[model samples]
Structures are given as C-alpha cells and as structure tokens.
Target chain A: MTAETLLTWARGSAFDWAIGIFVFGMVLRLIEVLSLGKKPDLAEGRGSGVKGGLKTIVTRSIPRASVFAREPVRITNGYVFHVGFLLVLLFYGPHIEFIENLTGLSWPALPGGIIAGLGMITMASLVLALIFRLRNPVLRHISTVNDYLAWAVTLLPVLTGYLAYSHAVLPYTAMLALHILSIELLLVVAPFTKLTHMFSFALSRWYQGYQAGYRGIES
Target chain B: MSGPSVEKGINFIREQIDAPVASFFSSCVHCGMCAEACLFYTQTGDPRYTPIYKVEPMRRLWENEFTLWGRIKSTLGIAKKVTEEDFAQWEELVYDGCSLCGRCSLVCPVGNDISGMIRKIREGFSAAGYAPEGLIGATTRAITIGSPMGVRLPALKAQIGHVEKETGIEIPLDRAGAEYMVLLSSMEIMNFPEYLQAIARIMRQAGRTWTISSKAFEATNSGIQIGASDLARELVQRVVDAAEELGVQTVISPECGHAYTAIRWEGPNLIGRPFKFKVRHILEVLDEFREQGLIKTRGKEQARLTFHDPCQLVRKGGVVEQPRHLLDLVAENFVEMTDHGAMNWCCGGGGGVSANERADELRLKAFRQKKSQLDEIGVETLVTACANCRITLEEGLEEYEMDIPVVGLTETLAEHLVEEDQEGQG
Candidate 1:
C-alpha cells in the first residue's frame, strides 16, 4: 500500500483496532484478576477495612514522610512523569479532539504552550528515570528486561507527539502517523505487560490496605 | 534437582496466585524502594535480600503459569522453572534474610504486602521439604511435644513451682472457671520465668481469676515459624481447646511476639471459627490494668531505658501503644528508639529466625539496624514485650558487646508493682 493509504488505514482502521484491543484486553484482564476472588477474611477486623482500603488508594500516591525522606528522588521524578503525562494526555487540545472523536467526549484543553512545555518535561523525567534505573545498583538488580521495555515504549509516544506537533522531525502527516503508530504499539502491548499497573495498582492497593487494615495497621 | 523435588512447591505457589498476588506481581513499578525498607537489604547491602526479590520464585511461577507472555516464554524454552537450586538459594533469602516484619509492606508505594507474600511463599518452601533444619526440628517437636523448644508439662510445672515459691502465691492450674487462660512460651518457661511470676503477681493483685493449663501452656507456634498452616492450626487449636475447656473468658498471650499474632490475628482463620474467648497480648491486658487503676506501681526504674517494639507484637499484632503506656508507669528515665512502635526495627530474630539457629550470623548482622537505633538513643535498659525479642535483643547487644540489658515489659512492670501484699493473701 502507498504511504498515504497506510497512514489513512493507520489513523482510521488501526486506531479502531487499537482502541478495541485496548478496551477488550483491559476488561478481560480485569475479569481474570478480579474473578480470582479471595476468601472473605474470616478473622475479625479491628477497624473499618473498607475505609482503610479507600484511604490507601489515595494515600499510597503520597509517600509517607519517612519514605519521602529516603526516596525523594524517585518520588519527585515519579510525580513529574505521572502528573506531566496526565496533563499532556488529558488537557492537550488535539488529544482532546481525538478523544472526542473516539468516545464522544470533549473537554477544554490547556494552552498549547503549556502542554508542550509539560510534555518536554515529562519526556526528560522519563529519561532521568531510565538513567536512574541503570545507574543505581539496587534498581539495576531488581529491574527486568520488561522494565526497560516499559520505559522505552512509554517515552516514544511523547517524543513523537511533540515532534509531530512541532513539525520538526518529519512531514506532518508522516510524523503524526508514526506517533499514532507508537501509541497503537503501546495500547497493544499494555494489557499484556506491566502497564496493566495503570488499572491494577489501585485495586492492589485496596486489597493490601484491606489486608493490613484488618489488624488496624494503617495501609 | 539434587534436593527434594519441588512439584508440591509449584502446586502450593500456584494455588496462592490470588488477586493480590497477581496484582503485586504485575504492578510492581521496579522502583526498589522496598530494599531501603528491608532490614536485611539495608544492613547487609545485599541486593539479593530485596524484599520483592526474596519471593522471585513465586513471581516467576506466577508469570509462567498465569501470564500470556510467560506461557509464550515457557513454550519458547526461555522461562526458568522453579528448581531445587532456586529453593536452596531462596531458603536463605526467605527464612534467614526476612523477619516478615511488614516494613517493606508499609513502605511500598504500590502497597504490596511483601512480607505477607513472603509468608505465603514460605508455605511452598516448607512444603517442598526445603525449610531450615532448626525450624523443621522445631515444627516436629511442636507437633509431637507441647512446645517448640521441647518444654514439656514437667518443665512448665517446675517453672510454675518456682514462681509460686518465689512469689508466695499459689499459681492456679486449669481452674474450670477462670476469667483468663494464660499461655506461656517455652522461652518464658526455660529462660524468662520472671514473665510467669509477673503475671501471677499482677493477676493476684488485679483480683482476676486466671490459670495456666497443663495441656496448652505453650503459645509460640513453631508450626507458624515453619510455615505449616496445618500444624499451626493444630497448635493454635490446642490453646483454643485449653481456653474453651477451662471455660475462660479470655486467653492472654504472654510476652511473646508471633505468639500474639498466631493467636490474636491468625487464630480464627487457622481454626476456621471464632474462639469462645478473646485474645490479648499480655501488654494489652496490663495496659488495661493500668487504665483501670488495677496496676499501681510503687517505684520507677532509675536507669535510662528504651522500649524495643517486637515486630510481631506491635507491627503484626497491633499491640503498639500498650508497651509505651506501661513504660510510662515504671520507667523513670524512659526514652524512645529512633524507630519505635509499629515502625520499629526487628530484633533480628523474629519470624522464627532465632529458632532457626542456622540464621544466627545473619540474624546478628540484621541486628545492626536495631543496634543503630539503640546507639542513637544510648539507653542502658532496653525493654520489650516478646520473649523471643528479648532473647534476640540480649544476644544482639552482647554480640556488639554493648552493656544494654534487655528486659521483658511484663517483668519490668512486675518489678515495680507496688509490692502488692507481700504475704500473698488477696
């Protein structure tokens, strides 16, 4: 097929396929995980476990004072990427337009300048994270091949998106097509990989909190 | 392949792949913060002892058995199966290196209960017959004899005789209508009989009817330390039956750490039903006495002291504030460790680490975390609630040749108990 034809299919059919796979795979993964239900804690609870569970989903994101003291770098850089990614993904105008087309939803976008600045910062934070992982002995020891893969795949779309929007890397159509293709790669790989953590992290925290909260330990 | 075949290990771990385990395996962000929280890792600077890494076998098993990519890797001959060698290496990591102290759990940004997962991983490890010899022998003795340390009825009776003679109070035995059934660790019977005498005196002064049962006097569950739930249930069942048979209103777990957890937290689940009575750590009961004005101390210790929170008693057992409350009662110059209460460092010999004598050197090494905490506070007397913790602390202090004396909270409180009725007639 011609590049024009491929780009059209990539934006149209490929986008539909990516969304379908992303949603269906994520829902199925959740079913597989959630269906393996635990036995009800037959042990008596000392406090409200549900309250602790809900509390952890929020509290876990904010590091404990002691933990932050020890891990200020990871926590600080971690939030940089996370918060930056959220800003770029949800508040960028074109991204919002695409979401509107896909899900029949629209919301006001932040100014282009701010989104671009945050996108660059997020991309740089990911690089620093990668370097931190490689340089730190403990992190290097614990990290798997998938850890590097997760980082690489996550960084690609942000870089390509910024390049495409800036019209600096290649022709607008081609760069945008590559950006979409990288995103499709992310969507396809996500459910099968650790990116499933995006959804699973909250549920896992809830379970963990529920488990410890039974003994009245703060999660 | 040289050791016992791990097919049963595989089966046990396979069954443990629940939602939390699945999510923990999937959602670990590979940040390595858990290493900072782990005593073994921080003290030894060994990355292998990373809390999450200790359970790598289970994680790998989860992947190969449960995940699509893992299945593909297995088909492609890329994934490593959990071998005997894996068990052999991890035996050190799981048993010696970890205290199941829950610090890693508390520190995980993702909220993974790494220690709880380690406890689950041990079910597989022990079932595969790869557990340490010390724990195995203890578990065996726990099943055959009444105590893990092989303390039998005669030994307990002898200790009871000593306490009764020393205190001039008739220690009750198997009274049918006592309000509480007191359980003792073999350590308390063999090494720290002061804990027993303290209870005897305090119960007498509080005017509460309590007794020790010949059948279920042992509280520390070697089965729990050995990671055999079946055997742990049997051991816990003994205490339950003894308490219920005595028709007691409560079962007071003596100054032992895991003993409290094994009974208070894990008791109902082990027996698959609620007990006929409540369970409380002896400190909790004493703190109750303090709160109720039943405990009146005559004097306070002049020596500088700090309380070391036993991992199981405070972190796992929720007996956090009781020891502090009791310390305020008798300690004149009491101070706090840098990390006291729920976040306190382990005495390096919990989760059966002390029982597994093979872990002696590593246990002493992990003691540095506690030692550093003590050094910063520079207290002369270290008080703790758990008998296991007290012994471990004493050993650690002695290893560093530090002059600190490790005392049980019960014994410490008993020393200052207003010298209640010297003639023993309540």
Candidate 2:
C-alpha cells in the first residue's frame, strides 16, 4: 500500500481494532485476576489495610532507600523513561489533539522543542534499559522473551514519533504511520505481557501495602 | 499420583493463585530489584537466588493456567510445565535460600510480594515431596511429638522443674481461667532455660496469672516452615485447643519469630477462624507490663548493645515498637543497627533454615549481611526478642569468632526488674 493509504489505515481501521482489543483484553485480564479473590484476613488487623493500600499506591512510585542505594542507575533510569514516556504521550501537541478528538477534553501541551527533547531522552533511556538488562546478571537471568518484546513495543512509539517529527529516514506519511502502528502494537500486546504491569501495579502495590499494614508495618 | 506428586504440587499452586498472588505475578517486570533486597542474592551474588525468580514454578503455573497468552501458548504446546525436576531443583531455593524475611517484598517497586509468593511456592514444593529432608523431619516431629525439636511434655516439665527451683516460683501447669497462657519453643525449652526463668520472674513481678499447658507448650510451627498449611493448621490447633481449654485471656507466643507469626498472623487463617483468645508476642506482653506499671526496672545494661529485630516478629507480626520500648527500659547504651526495626536484616536462620542442615553453609554465608550490619555499628552485646534469632546470632558470631554476646530482650528486662520482696505464687 502507498504511504497515504498506510497512514489512513493506521489512524482509522487499524487504530479502531487496536483500541477494541486493548480495552476488551484489559477488562478480561482484570476479571481473570479479580475473579481469583483472596480470602478475608481473619487475624485481627493492627492497622487499616485500606489506608495502607492507598498510601502505597503513591509511595511505591519512589524507590525504597536500600534499593535506591544498591541500584541507583536502574532506578533512576526507570524514573526518567517512565516520566518521559508519560509526559510525551500526554503533553505533546499532536497527541493532545488526538486525545481531545476522542475524549472531548483539551489540556495545555508542552512546547514542541521540549517534547522533542523528552522523546529523545525517553528513547535513549529505553535503549539504556535494554543494555542494562542484558548486562546485569540478575536481570539477564530473570528476563524472558516477553520482557524483550515488551521493551521493543514500548520503545518503538517514542523512536518512530521522534523520527516522524524530525522527518528523518522515512517519508513523513510512512513515519507517522509507523508511529501510530507502534502504539497499536503496544496496545495489542500489553494485556498479555509483562506490560500488564501498567494496570496491575496498582493492585499489586495495594495488596503489598495492605499485607504490611495489617501487620502494622509500613511497606 | 494421589500422594505428594507433581500433579498435587500443581494443584496446590492453582489453589494458591488468589487475587493478591495473581496481581503479584502479573505485575512483576523482571527488574531484579528484589535481588538487592534479598540477603541470599546479595551475600551469595547468585542470580538464581533473586527473590522473584525463586517463585518460578508458581509464576509459570499462573501464566499457563490463568492468562490468555498462556492459554494460547498451552494450545501450541509451548508453555513450560511444572515438573518433578522443577520442584526438586527449586526445593533449595525456596526453603534453604530464602528466610521468608519479607525484605524483598518491601523493596519491590511494583510491590510484588516476593517473600509471600515464596511462602506459597513452598506449598507446592512440600506437596510434591520436594521439601528438604531436614524440613520433612521437623514437620514430622512437630506433628507427632508436638515439637519440631522432638521436645515432649516431659522435657518441658524438666525445664519447668529447673526454672521453678531456680526462681522459687511455681510454674503454673494447665491452670484454667488464667490471665495468660505462655507457649515455649523447643529452642527455649531445651537450649535457653533462662527464657523460661525470665518469664516466670516477669510474670511474678507483674502479678499476672499465667500457665504453661502440659498439653501444648511448643509454639513454633514446622508446618509453616515446610509450607504445608494443613500441617501448620494441625500445629496451630494444638495451641488453640489448649488455650481455649484453659480459657486463658491471652496466649503469649514465646521469643521465637516464626511462632509469633504462625500463631498471631497465620494461625487464624490456617485454622479457618479468628482465635477466641488474644495472641501476644512475649515482647508485646512485657511492653504492656512496662506501660501498665505492672513491672518496674531499676537498672540498665552497662555494655554497648544493639537489638536484632527478628524478621517475622517485626515484619510479619507488627511487634516492632514493643521490643524497642522494652529495650529502652533495660539498655543504657542501646545503639540501633543500620537498618533496624521493620527493615532489619534477618539473622539468616529463620523460616526453618536452622532446622535444615543442608542450608547451614548458605545460611551462614547469608549471615554476613547481618554481620556487616553489626560490624558497621560496633556493639558489645546484641539483644533480640526471638529465641531462634538468639541461637542463630550466637552460631553466626561463633563462626566469625566475634565475641559479642547475644541475649534475649525478655531476659535482659528480667535482669533489670526491680527486686520485689513479696513474690507471690502464680
């Protein structure tokens, strides 16, 4: 197909299919998890699980003191890429306009130059994360093919978006189509891979905090 | 196939895959942050000892049985299956390498309860008959002899006889309607008689009525360590039956960390109901006594000292502040360890590691984490609330030829208790 046809397909029918699968898969994934309900703690709780759960939902974003000390590079890299990814996704002018069309909400967008810089940083961080994963003995040992695939799907959007914006290598229409397609790939694979952590991290953090809090210890 | 086999193990894993565990497995990003928090990984520098990786069997089972991708993989015959070999290989990792210290759980950025999952994974290991012989032996003794160390009631009575003669106080036996019923670990009954003496002295001074059931005195649950909840439940029921039979207001778990967790935290769930009587750690009881002015202390230790917070007591039992409060009343120069309280490094002998002879070398190696913590803050004495921690610290210290003495926090408080001239019988 021509670049124009690819761009139209990427932004229209392909995007529609990707969003549908993403939403349905996420809901099904959530059901699979929630349906396996945990037993109520019969032991007398020393503190409130709900309070701890809510607190941990916020607190777990920050690395623990010992872990940060031991693995500062990985933790710092994680923060940079995660924040950069979210900022670029939410604050880019075109992304906001796209979101506004769907959600009927508009927000202030970061400047083009700043978003470009963040996109570059995020892409670099993603590459560094892969290198770190490959080099670190523990990470290398624990990571599976799913981890690598998740990393690729996450990295592609940033890379393609940056390339499309700078009009580098590929034609503008093809590059933009690639950017949208990369995101669609991410959405399709997310619910079935470790990328599911994007949604389940909240549940995981809450449970950990609640368990700790029940014992009157902070996580 | 019906007995402890691979199929049974897989079924147990399926049973254990509740929402929290499911969430935990799903959220793991393989960042390996858990390794930094685990003493086994940090001390041994073994990538295999990474906390999340140790639960590989459970994670695999969850993925294959619970996920859509897993279903597709299974259909394609590409899914990894939990095998007898997997169980055999992982037996050491789950039982020997891990102390169930919960450090990894706390440090996980995604909040995966790595230690909790390890605990669950042990169920599969134990069910598949892949549990170490040492743990199997302990569980058998705990079920058959009412103590993992094979300490019978007669042995406890012998220790009670010694304590009674030494303190000139009657040790209440099977007394009904007592305010508190105290349970003892075999470690305390066999190795640390002074812990019993301290309890007697403290209880007498506090003027609280207490009893040690000839029926169920042992508190430590080998089933918990072995990761068999059914076996754990049987052990817990002994304490429950005795406490309820005596109608004690509270059952005091002795200075053993896992015993406190088994009885105070996991006991109710294991037995399928809330305990009729309250369960309090000995440290919590002593702290309560201190707060109520039921006991008084006139002196503090002269030696520079530090408190080793037992992992189960602080991390799982929530008895953190109570020990610190009790320690404050006895130690003049109490220096906190670098990562004290809930974040304290385990003594590396908990979660049945001390019982499993196969893990001795690795356990000792893991002790370096605790050793370095102590080495960083030089102390003349180490005080801990758990009897198991006391023995483990002593062994680790002896292995290192570090002459610093380890003492029980309860005994330390007992030593400083103001002499009450009118000592009444229990």
Candidate 3:
C-alpha cells in the first residue's frame, strides 16, 4: 500500500476509537494513582534542612541504581522489554506517519521489519516473564489477577500486529484493527494496574535516594 | 522422570510445615527489590545474601514439592534435590545474612513477609537439630536453667544483695501479694548489675509495692529468638505464674526485645489465657515515671545521643514514641538517626543472630547499614531500649571500627538519676 493509503487508514474509525480508549484509560489511571493513599513522608527524621532533604532523595535513589547495576543480566532483559515496547508504540512507521499528518510534527521511523522484529522480541520476553511467574510457585502465589491481565494485554497487541503482518485467515485491516484495539486496552489499563508501578517505582526510588543522601549514608 | 518420588517429597514437605506458615512461604515474587533493603547484600555485594536469594531454597521446596507445577518439575528431574550441601549453604545465608529485621517486609510491594519466612525456616532448622551450635546451647541453657545467662540462684541472690548494699534499698525477694512484679533479664543481673539497682531505685521513688521472685525473675526468653514457640511459651508462663503468685497489677519487662515479644504477644497465646496484669517495657515504665515527675534525671549534658529502635520493640510491639520521649527527657543533645523508630535499621544481632556463630560474616555485613546510619548522625553514644540491641550495637561498633558507645535507655537514665531523688519518700 502507498503511504497515503496507510495515512488514510490511520485517520479512519479504527484510530479514532483507539484514541478515545487511550484518553479514557488515562483518566482511569489518574484515579488509581490518586487512590493509593498519601505518599508517605519517608524523610521525616533523617534531617530537615534544605540541603539535607535534597541529599536524602539523592542517596536513597542510589540503592535502586545499584540494584540495576548489581544484576545487569536481569535488568538488561527488563530494559529491552521496556525500551523496545516504547519504540514500537511511539516510533513505528504507520503510527509516526499518522501522527505527523495529524499534529503537523514529524519524526523519523524505524523500518517496518525492524519495528515488527522488536515487537516480537518484546512479546517473547514478556511471555518468558509470565511463564516464569507461573512456573515459580512463590511468584504464582503473590501474583494478582491484574498481573495476568497486564501480561495478556501486553501480549495481545504484539500477537495481533504479527498476525496482521502475516495476513492470516483474517483480513489484514481486521487484524490491524484488533491490534490497535489491544494497544488501546493496554494504554487504558497501564495507570490502574501494578503497571502504574512504572511511575511509583521512580518516585519511591527517588525518595529513598534523597533520604539516604541527606543522611550522608550509602543507601 | 518418576511421579512416585515427587509424591514422596511432597508428603515429606507437607509433614514438615504447618498450613499458615507454608502458605506464607509460597508467596514471594523473587523481584530482588528486597536485596536493596538488605544490609548484608549492600555490604558484601553478595547475591546470595539478598533477602530474595536467601529464601530461594524454601521457595524452591514450596514449588517443586508442594505445588502442581513443582511436582511436574520434580517428576521430570528438572527440580534440584535438597542435599546436605544445600542445607549447609543455606545455614549461613539464612542465619547470618538475615537479621529478620522486617525491613524487607516493609519495603515489599506485595507485602510479602520475608522476615516471617526466615523465622519459619529457622524453626524448621531448629526442629531438624541443624540450628547453630551456639544458639542451640543458649536455648538449651534457657530451658534447663532459669535464664539463658545460666546464673544460678546463689549468684542471682548475691547480685541482689550487692544492689541492696550499694543503694541501701530493700530488694524484696518472692514477696507475694505485692502490687507489681519486676522481671529482669539475666543480662542485667550478670553483665549490668546496675540495671537491677536502677529498677529498685525507680520502684522506691514511685513508692510502688513490688517484689522480685527468685524463681521466675528472669525475663530473657531465647525461645522467641530461636523461633521455638513451645520454649517461648514456657518461659512466659513462668513469669505469668510468678505474677499471679505475687498478685501484681503489672509485670515490667527489662531492656530486652525478644523478651518483650515473648511476654506480650506470645505470653497470652501460650498460656491459653489473656494476662490480667499489664506488661510494660522498661522504657515505657520510665516514660510514665518521667511524665508523672517520679524520677528526675540530671547530668546527661556531655552525651550527644541517638536512639536505635529495636525491631521487636518498635516494629512488633508499637513502642516507638515512648523510648524517644524518654531519651528527649534525659539527654540534653538528643539527635534522631535517619532510620529511627519503626523504620530503624536492625543492630545485626536480633532474631538470635547474635547467638548464631555461622552468622558472624553476615552479621558484620548487616552491621554496615546501621554503622553508616550512626556515622551520619555522628553521635557520641547510641542509646537503645533493648538489651539485645545494646549487645548487638556494641559488637557492631567494634566490628565496624566505630567509636560510638552503645547503651540501653535505662542504662543512660540510671547514670542520670538524681542523688536526692533516690532518698525514700515512700
């Protein structure tokens, strides 16, 4: 298909529904974040001076950085899954082209094959993680329904995208439509599920870092 | 691949654990975020010391021997067998690497109680006669003798006589029908005899009618530390029976962490009835005395002090503010450490960590976390409310080459007791 045909498809009913779902999901996520009781003041007694508070945030955060540094292999797998997922979501050829046409802003895109390949890898990693969670009783016991939901939503988009690319028994447009729907579902669920941990993890790490640094101790 | 062996292993595992404890053991996610919370992991940079890794063996057993997926793995020969080597490796990892401080439990996103799991594993080890020799010796002494210190009746009476002679105060022994019964840990009678003297002075200042039983006066319970519920109960029952015989309104626990938990949480459950008399930690008793203006403290000016919250006392007992309030009353220059109150770092000697010789390296490793916190405050002395914490901090300071002195809150208070205030008004 020509670039114009792809652009026209993106601006059609499928994209509009996806956008609506994305907006609604974001609102739901905001509600979830607000509901997690007040952010605890972890720096209550360490020190109170301006410099001390800043130091605490910085020092406490070092533990989190050290965590990633200490276990590079596991962390690298996590990084690839996250970064690759983001690249496909934001910089895929059709998505970027559509965004450029609509917003009058343009960015370079990864080739179709590269985006699809990255998508496949991200999906595979996520599947491996889910399998690990299930196979390990310790993890299985702690996991919530939402954790499984997150894996399913995360995997659905990639699976549908691959199916659309392969043009299986379903029409290519239908497969693309399902893929877009699944992606929208994930975007909406992100803020509500433990997936919102993405935001809280950074905040918690920063708070711990600041407290440790303020106290002039290695976190 | 065989199913019969897997079934046998599953039955063996089930026979070893109670239901509630087993369920809790099966709930870790292995995210290793708990590693960041572990001081041993931080100090030694050892992955095995990470709280998550430390519990992996227990996790594996819970999976392969108890769960369906684990059973499948066992049948396929994919699950590793638990060898004596595995036990030996885990002995060091669980005993020394973890203080059972509950810090990891506090930070767990899923609220997995890693400390509780460690305690349960310790229980398993203890049952299997695999507990550290020192800890087993201590527990054995505590069970056979009246106290873990093994101070017999003659020595205890001599210590009491010495206290009476020094203070010119009557140290009542086995005085039944008293209003309060004071239980002292063996550490106080053996190591810091002044603590017993201070207790007498406080009771006299308040004009309280109290007695100390020669038989059941020891309050230090090793069972709580070793995760031996039966022994912990027996220890607490001794105190309860003595309190009943004395008809006391309250039983005051000495400056010990596990001892307080033994009497407070496990005391009632073990005795199969709720205690009528209130159980109070020494810090709480002092806080009350200070509030009522019963005990006046002086000459704490040179002491720049900070309070280390004992894990059992603060986190488990909810006795945070009382100790700090007492410290504020006594010390002129009271500074709070970064992790004070319920969030305080463990002194690396709790949960029987002090008695476990194999835990030495892990203990020192964990001490670095607390050492760094103390260094940040730069205090002259670290005043804690628990006797175990006092010992742990003293050892930790020496191991870490820190200059800070570790003293109990009551010990510091005893040093500041006003001379005129000691004269009997009652």
DockQ for all models, in order? 0.68, 0.85, 0.06
State the lDDT of candidate 1 residue by residue for B1-426, as single tens digits: 534458887677777789888888878888898998888888898899899999999999988877777888999999988888888889988999888888888878888889989988988889888799999999999899978889999988888888888888898898999998999999989998998888888887788999989899999998778788889999999998888888999899888888888998888988999777889878889989889999878879999998888888777777788888888888889998766776787888889889888999999999898888888988888888888888888888889999988888888888888763556483
Residue B369 in candidate 2 has what lDDT? 94
Task: Summing lDDT over every window of 10 consecutive residues in candidate 1 chain A, give the lowest-scoring window.
Answer: A35-44
**Comparing 1 and 3 on DockQ, the stronger one:** 1
Better of 2 and 3 by TM-score: 2
Q: Quote the lDDT for A58 in model 2.
A: 88
Cα lDDT tens digits for candidate 2, B1-426? 234588888888789899999999888999999999999999999999999999998998899989888888999999988787888788889999999999998889988888988898888888888888998999999899888889998888888888888888999899999999999999999998999999888888988999999999999999999899999999999999999999999999999999998999899999999999999988888888889999888888889999999999888777778888887887789899878887899999999899899999999999999999999999999989888889899999999989999988888888988766746444
Across A139-207, the per-residue lDDT of candidate 3 in tens digits comes to 554556657887888888878877887676477766776676676677666644555444444343333
Instruction: Evaluate fnat for each of the predicted models and list the values in order.
Output: 0.65, 0.86, 0.02
Candidate 3 matches the true fold with a TM-score of: 0.68
- After TM-score superposition, the amount by which residue A41's alpha carbon in candidate 3 deviates from its true location, in angstroms, is 30
Clashes of 1: 0
Best by lDDT: 2
Q: Which is the winner by lDDT between candidate 2 and candidate 3?
A: 2
Backbone clashes in model 1, listed as residue pairs: none
From the highest TM-score down, the ranking of the candidates is 2, 1, 3
